[model samples]
Target: MAVQENLLLGAKASKNATLTLVFLSILKGVVGFYSGSASLIADAIHTSLDIFTSLAVWIGLKLSMRGSEEKFPYGYYKADNLVSLFVSIIILFSGVELVREALLNIASPVEIKLQGIALGTAVFSVIAMYALSQYKFKVGKQIDSQALIADALHSYTDVFSSLIVAITIIGSLLGVLWLDSAGVLVISLMIFKLGIGMAKDSILTLMDAWLDKDSIERIRQNVGSIQGVKTVDEIRLRKSGLVVFGEIEIEIEGDASLKRVEMLFEEIEKTVKNEVKNLEHLVVNVKPEKISVMKIAVPVLMQEGLHSKVSRHFSKAPYFIFIELENNDIISWDVSENPAAGLEKKKGLKAAEFLKDQGVNVLIAGEIGEAPFHTLRDNFVKLLQMPEEIEDVEQVVKKVSELNTLTAPTE
Candidate 1:
């Protein structure tokens, strides 16, 4: 339901319960006064307190419906839980009072008349409270309103207490005077139990407990299914009122462009929103996976490690072929004599085939003819043009790292 409609429904329900309880409280109070029944008076007090409880429920629902602000970016969804917590405390206090009164009555029995008026009032209350409880329970469940549910449960307890009151008064008139206090004591204990349960639920919500495992798994599966996503690194979700808030981190290919990554993020958002319902806020963090190093081969004249110069004459015999393994920086380097160096016949073809067999990812060179270039191209080797004058292996490696090219012009 829309926010405004939900708020209106909550207001209507609260108003109905408040008015109904008010009328019943007055009726019970008058009947209790005339009949002089202690149990009726106690029940009247309980009904009267429910008026305030229903009011709390309405206020909580209204507050919870408010939109997020600068100070409260997550909105007021926890207001309902806070109110429920307070209502539980109130119910607990009421139970303590009932227990004290029951003990006192049991210790010093007060002779009081149990008239037909008291019995009629108890029966009337039982029927009225039960009907109201059922209505509130249905509405509360429909809206997923915790405050409303708490109030409904509180009212339902009244139904039981009313029945107990009737039974106790009847038993007292039948000469078992202790039954009156005993029944009140039992009702008080039940109220305490209900209050403890409601408080536990409210506290769990207020603490931002994670949603069920199944719901989190569903979210993970949906987001992880998007194209270009390498993995779902992490996902966390918590319920706030009827809405869910989540944070997700995903890994994607390291080579994905900025635009491609952005598009993947958008897809993740759409996929999750479509699959998961009632998500209020979602924060997505994208991390690119690390790229592995490329092994580059440079045909060169080398006397030492750093003093290597590119061989000016391509396809000619070179003193050394430097294979530079690189990631962010050159992690290591290895030198091997060109096996096809100064070959008598088909020198370029032999050299190209030799480099291809070396499993070279890329070949940096000065110049080479069409035949050898085609052979390297067919072999899926990447070619990068480097200055013949460049003598530093580090400089060639840097150029190889910075440049993304294949089939450089023969210079």
Candidate 2:
């Protein structure tokens, strides 16, 4: 739906710019011939090139939107780059032609009978071209169309050339005849530089250059924040007309089940697409990391060091002691108050979340409930059950150390 709207608005903007250029071209030609303003006639010729450029932009918008997955898998988006190249060539030729005419006029200075009609026409062209440029620029930004933006810039050059014509008319009346030709020379050089820049950008886009730095960085930050993502491995993006296509690679723990992996993939995709406004599609690749250390969380009734007795219930515990493990040995342990303790309802789910946020890889709970069991499993936190008979923290840790003694939760 959004793509359709962009195409519609883009077509309208480019089409309107083309029609305006045609009107300005005719208006300048008739006025310049009768008034004997050589610079105005040269500007008229430049306006003609603008007509071609605007027309090409309109055509490009139409062709670029003809993307089909079955027919042309990569789409016809490259047509926009082709159109941009064509616009660049037209600008270069027009500038060269105008520059040559300016030099000839300077060599053999011509007398101008500057009439009010000629001056009025030049000023009017300035107003019209400026308005057209603004319109095209706004629409181009909204639709994210590079070709339309280039057309807007072409219209801006028209504004500069028209202003030059007005200045030339004033100079002719002031008897500074050389100023008219000099103004045309300045206008030509300005447009020539613009054409070179546009051509360079078009060539680079054709070569599949990476997206700009700011956009890539924003995507990276957003994707790296997903809960299960251990690392953001790669992000590759390219623009096709107004849309962006991308591939992203991320890392998570090795123990994540298939369902958990799928969930992480979905979240990563959502984050990336939301960060970039023009993203069309993304492929997420998930890799697993070989974890060396894991944490075990046990709900304790007292805050006593190591000897804290186990709580009677999962969420009703007063504190949680996280045991850090490397291989089968205990490396260290620390305890923190359970934020969800003493809750009348939904305690199991909230307590499960608290443990997950603490990076608990394995949980030691003798009286685990059903709701919290599923929650921990979904977060890839392993469940281990020790005998409720041995209640001391040190004794529970010793029992869980022998992997075979601990019973895991099951469906």
Top TM-score model: 2
Give one digit per residue, the lDDT tens place, for model 1 in 100-151. 8788888766544746777888999999999999999988877667788899
Clashes of each: 0, 0
**How does each model score on TM-score?**
0.68, 0.70
Each prediction's Cα lDDT score?
0.78, 0.82
RMSD of each: 10.0, 11.2
* Cα-based lDDT at residue 119, candidate 1: 83
Candidate 2, run of 10 with poorest lDDT: 402-411
Residue 411 of candidate 1: its Cα lDDT? 33
User: Per-residue error at 380 for model 1, in Å?
Assistant: 24
Compared with the true structure, the alpha-carbon lDDT of candidate 1 equals 0.78
